[model samples]
Target chain A: MSILVIAEHDNKELNPATLKTLTAAQAMGDDIHVLVAGEGCAAVADQVAKAAGVAKVLCADHAAYGHQLAENISALVVSLAKDYSHVVAPATTTGKNFMPRVAVLLDVAQVSDIISVESADTFRRPIYAGNAIATVKSDESIKVITVRATAFDAVAAEGGSASVDALDAVFESDKVRYVAEQVAASERPDLSSARVVISGGRGMQNGENFALLEKVADKLGAAIGASRAAVDAGFVPNDMQVGQTGKIVAPELYIAVGISGAIQHLAGMKDSKVIVAINKDEEAPIFQVADYGLVADLFDALPELENALS
Target chain B: MKILVAVKRVIDYNVKVRVKADQSDVDLSNVKMALNPFCEIAVEEAVRLKEKGTAEEVVVVSIGPKACQEQIRTALALGADRGIHIETDTMPDSLAVAKLLHKVVDEEQPQLVILGKQAIDSDNNQTGQMLSALTDMPQGTFASEVQVDGDKVNVTREVDGGLQTIELTLPAIVTTDLRLNEPRYASLPNIMKAKRKPLDVKTPESLGVELGSKVSVLKVEAPAERSAGVKVADIAELVDKLKNEAKVL
Candidate 1:
């Protein structure tokens, strides 16, 4: 049976995460269709039509799905679930919010944040904050999955000319209303998709100290992130937190500053291609994961690194 | 308004879980288990709502072995009014868990259902949303802040890019995020008080729910390890290697 991928996008622009999810879809089978559900998101549908390996794009444009909220989006996906054997999305917050409802309505189990697709029915996923990997098999007829973007290489966006189809569905979320979105206003690339990530932990001491990392990040065109402890200590906003409970990122270069990495913190960024840990403690767990570990006070190393990079 | 919170018993967040030699599952034979961290946040939120008069009553529930009552009691000690234990030895799939919770929701008729977004163990992150689907309630997942009015609940969610706020009509579901609140410890007096709180044990059968596993564990193994590497002498050496060798700079 064919697969349907729920495209992850905010009305204006398509998120790169959709490409990563499509990469996983390509591995599963060739008959892949992407469903772009949003209000006035024809642009997103157009982008999906260009994603490599997809057969078609399903654009479900309606006022009811203005924000891709769970209530209506789940209904739209459920309506389209009949034609496909598998429905998948990038394991972002948007996917996590709605996929379970689709699984439940379809009488199937949702295999979430799958790192690899062993077979059509079998999958590998990390459990307990990446300490152990569990290979799970679904017995349900229709498989619902959320793909961890970092596990798969993103497919080229300009390589295919898949046809776009408009799917109309009567869907509305009666019980939930959009309030307000407070996005962290930043010019830097998104942490999850960035090529470089310069992260600071609690030892950065305060919010002002993050400026040091920001300087280095600016030189490298990298995104700024924080450990859970740094976020908890109010050294940065919660959105910047990188850990098991926060965003999982696998940038090409991950520079961990003053972060004595807890296993929870390691779970998020350990998959980076090259890791550099800068901490005063030689015994920091962050060092263990780092390809290059620097043992010195962050106050001393921060400036020198910033100067060297600049 | 009444708030119903679901707590799950999982391997304590601090424990270093080890995979078994046979590759079946993690060795939980004698590992210390506790209430899931997110569930604790859920319980803490429910208790805070009760304390602030936003919720008139707080009820805590768990679906697991009888030992899960210990987690429920912990929730009660933190401040739930009562506990409901859906006692079972094996964990039913998320759908089954939602079905069982559906029965309790029908009986209790609470205005709000607060649950952990996912347990650290198994981490399917589906039960609350599934319950919302089966029960026909709007859900706010990964919620960091929840503010309740007469019939409206505004939840500030921790989304991918930043925070998104959504207002859910009453009788909605909210799954807790880590930053919602720091859960308070159960003091000795409160722990003793929780022992006297009403604790009702029920079964999935009693709720007329068919609990079955739709997913099977094929195998389990340790994740690929990243061994410790060499320590650089200074910032100069680090930059030299990053540019000349690894070339990520």
Candidate 2:
């Protein structure tokens, strides 16, 4: 049976998470279809058509889909769900918002944030904030799942010659209205997808000290992250938080400066290929997980590390 | 206007979860349990709405075994007007929970329904969205800020990049995020008074909702632990180890 991969994009561009989701879809089966629902997203549809392993691209263009409203998008996905054996979406904020609705309307269960595909019906996921991993099996005929993009390697984006087909389904919701958005713009790569990530914690003391991490991040061309304590202390915004409840990242190289490594914070980044912990406290829990531990005062180490990089 | 808030009792966040030797599930034999933190935030938001005169009454509900009534009473002590306990032996999946809540929403007919974005134990951020689907109501999830006007509510959501504000019509659902508000502790006087508040109990069979689960757990296991590594003497040695040994530089 064919699988449907819901493309995650923002009208003009496709999110890299969708590529990772496609990788999971490929593991389930070979026949895969990509659905791009947005306003004036013909370009995104064309991009999906070129993605490797995509058999076809279904484009739903309408003003209502521009924001990817759950009420409207779920209805549309439900409309097309019967023809496919499986429906998969990236576990982004957008996917988490709407995928459950799709599961319920289809009278099935959604396997949220599956890190591995043990089988078509069985999968592995984190529970209790990643403390334990559970393998779950679904008996429903149509399997609905949300993929943790960081766990899967993304497929090639430009290799296939799949056909792009337009879908004329309109679901305009009157119960909700879009107001405004405030997205943090940065020159650094996205925190989740970046190869190298540098993070701080409460030991950074205040918001101003985050600048020191930024200087190091600039030198390494890495994304900046923070612990929940740092965010709670108002040293940074909530979006920069890295923990069990926040965004999860599994980068190639992860550097923790002044972070004591609470269990929740460790759950988010412990999967990194290589980890470096720099803290003044010798008994910090982060040192237990670090491949290379450096006991140092970050105030003295940041400038020296940046200079050495040059 | 009346507001409905849902709470859950789960293993305390401070507790380190351990998988059973048989791989059935996480061991919960004698661990301390508390109100789910995000649900506490939802209860706080509802109580605050009533305190601000935007809501006339705040009703708190919980679904689980009889022990969950303790959480409901805690919500009442925190300033909820009444409490409802939907008793069951095992925890239901998110869909079944949503179905049960849909029946409660039908009975209460509140103008607003508030719940935590996700439970700390299951960590499946699904019930609120599922309930919204069943009730056909607009949903504002991961809400950091909620402001109820005359006929509409504006919710500021914590999205991936930053924040996004959306306005929903009356009779909507808002899920509380971490930054929603700091939940308050129950005062001594309120704790004594809450014992006298109205409390009701019902079952899923009485509500005409089936408790059958479509998903089954195969096994539960601990994640692979990372072995401790070497500690460098200085920054230069750390750089050399990264470039030469780890090759991650």
Candidate 3:
């Protein structure tokens, strides 16, 4: 069976999640084709052609797709969905925005975020805020699925020589207009893809205290994350939240500082290979799941940890 | 302008969800239930619009078994003008739910529709987008801020990296994010007043929408437990354990 993966990328570079999605798609089928739909995205098409396990890359470069509007992207995917047995995309905000539209147009129930591909139709996903795992099977002609990138390892970025083809399709809608975007600038790695992630919580007290995390993150070459409590308390922006309702990360090492591990917070980072918790409250639930538990005040621990790392 | 806000009754956010031993689904027997958090934000946003005089009426809708009416009443207590309970025995898939909402949208013709970005139970962030597709309307999902002008609405969305502001024409769909606004608690007197609010109960057949699920759950089980490991007395030992034992450093 042939599969079509909607590549997540800007015109400049492909999202690392796309590589993980490609790996998930490869597990489901051999004949996998990548669709790079964006304005002036030929570079992304060229990059996907070399990604391992891809058979072909279809580049649909158009001004209408530059912003990845849901109305336009859904129409584009629906138009070409007739040729594939399965359609997949990474479960990023962009993919979540458009994939459901594709499902409704196709009159099928789209699988939200599958973590494992049991087969072409059956897959495993988390539900109830990652407290439960549900194995689901789809009975539709074309299975529409979103892959949780953290659950799958990324495929090799190179070693394939798939042919790149231009796809002439444009669907523009006048109902929506892009105004502006304020992307958070960070010198550290992206949290979702970083190997090491250090997060703060309510115990960080205020936003200014995040500098302590920044110092430690700089030493570890890691990404900075925060719990929902910290974000809700305005200690950090919403983008930094790692929880059931926020971004999910499964890094090689996750250090949760002064965070009372709520279940929602645990849902996001419990998959990390190594978990370390530092909290003043000895009774904090975070210590229950932590691989290394250190009960201490973050203010004192932060300085000590920074010096130790140095 | 009239606004439509969709809400869902999910297990209370504070409750620890447990998987059933039979593996059929999550065990919700005698568990506390409340309005889904994101949907509460949607309701709050709509109520705020009405309070700001941008919206004349705010109508809330919920689809589920009769038990979901509790959530509808909760929304009414929070200042929704009316409530619509689409009664059904089984939980339909996201697409089916969207189609039902589409039928309501056709009947009500509200100028704007707001819903939660995702339900806490299924965590399927699809219904609002699917409803937007079925109605051929624009959507602003994961909205942190929403401002309604004469014929347009500016939605600041919380995306992957940061925030994006998109303008959609009237009659658009919006799904709320966490930072949209802090939802307020309903007062006791307001709760009593909500009991008198007009709540219409309708069936899927009444809307002429056939509801069925295309996906079936093969099994449901608890996530693999991560047992606690060694405790470190100090920062030095913690760093040593990471570099030597776990080797993640």
Candidate 4:
């Protein structure tokens, strides 16, 4: 039984989460192949071919897959489903959008966001905001899964000599038309791939105060993130949210400023290597998960921390 | 003019869940249950569409044990017109559920179908997309805002980067995101009116669909606990600790 892993890229660079998915795929019987589905993604496909465990790369270059639309990619993936025993992708927004359609097109079920693969047929996933973990066994002939990228360590991106193939299929969903996407621009590293992250919560009060975090994040070369409360308060964009329903990140260091960590927020970043929480409220739940807790006003702590770091 | 919304009953968000002694599943023997938060948002969106005169009827559906009717009724109390309950003991995976929903779609001929992105129990996040595939309809998942126009529906989705807007043909599928709408609490009078609303019950077999879980629960366990460390009195010590003790800096 072999595995076909889906690759995620921004036309120019690959999302590190795809490599983590590759790591998970390598563990599940290793005739591991990858799919780079996009317009002009030949370079991305070449990059995927160099991943240490990959055996082959399939680059599906078509206009319909330019935005990595689910409607287009689902058909392309489903078209190739019959040849493999397992299909895996990282549990990102793009993968989550398409894999379900592939499973239904193949008349199979999807096992989503598994943290661990107990066996080829069995997996473990978090439920109820990580309060409990469920070990599930699949009965389907062809297994469809989305791996939680935070749970698996990425394999080295080099040291392989796999061949790349072009898929000549024009998969399109005619009823839906993609218009435009507004991506937030920042000079700092991406939240998912960054080694250090600094997050703010509701106590930041408003968007203006986030500048404090910007300075500190700049000093540390860290990415900026926000709790759900901060996003809900209109202090940050939803993309900056770090919680159960938001981006799950596991950086080398996570600094939470004024964030009263909800269980959902904790679920996303609790896996970080070292967590530091700064909140005036001593009883804040964030302290429980923080390796270092500071009970002080963030207004005072932010500038002082910035000064101290500089 | 008809909108169909899918609701799911899950462990109450407030209750601290406990792992069963046998590790079969979470101990749900006598725990309080509520409508999944995301589903509540779905119901709210459907009701708002009706209230705005964009939809003539709002129908809520739940696929689960008989107790799931409570969730359907909650949707009714929140302004849905009627309810449909797909009764089953064994929960079906997203594909089977989508197949069953596809059958319902064929019979009901609704103009729109709305569902929560995923359920809290299994968290598959696949059913709405699967239903759209099985039914040959366009879909918009993780929608934060929805606007319906004649022959078309504009969906603004909360994508990973920021926002992505897409236009889908009418009679489409949309899965709700948390920021879509604020679900209202059922008032006393509305709750009373909901009890009298029509609620039809059927089974997967009755609908001519075979439903079963493709993924079986092998075990359940509590996650590893995060051990707490010491608190810092000031920023200087915190920076000192990060530079030397943790070595992350």
lDDT of 4 by residue, A1-310 (tens): 7799999998777889998888888777789989999988988999999989899999998889999888899999988889899999999889999999999898888889989888788888998888899988888888999999988999999999899999898888888998778888789999987999999999999999999999999899999999999998898888999988889899999999999988889988999999999999999999998999999999999999899888
- Sorted into a CAPRI-style docking class, model 3 comes out as high
Cα error of candidate 1 at position A252, Å: 0.8
For candidate 2, what is the TM-score? 0.99
TM-score of each: 0.99, 0.99, 0.99, 0.98
Assign candidate 1 its CAPRI class.
high
Error of 1 at A120 (Å): 1.1
Q: How far out, in Å, is residue B43 in model 4? A: 1.1
Tell me the spans in candidate 4 whose CA falls farther than 4 Å from its real position: none
Using DockQ as the measure, the top candidate is 3
Of all true interface contacts, what fraction is found in model 4? Answer: 0.90
The sequence of per-residue lDDT tens digits that candidate 3 reaches over residues A120-211 is: 88999999989999999999999999999999999999999999999888999999999999999988899989999999999999999999
Whole-model lDDT, model 3: 0.94
Candidate with more favorable, higher lDDT: 1 or 3: 3
lDDT of 1 at A19: 95
Worst 10 residues of 1 chain B by lDDT: B205-214
Tell me the TM-score of model 4. Answer: 0.98
The alpha-carbon lDDT assigned to residue B69 of candidate 1 equals 89
Q: Every model's DockQ, to 2 decimals?
A: 0.88, 0.89, 0.90, 0.83
C-alpha lDDT (0 to 100) for residue A23 of candidate 2: 90
Clashing pairs in 4: none
- Chain B, candidate 3: TM-score: 0.98
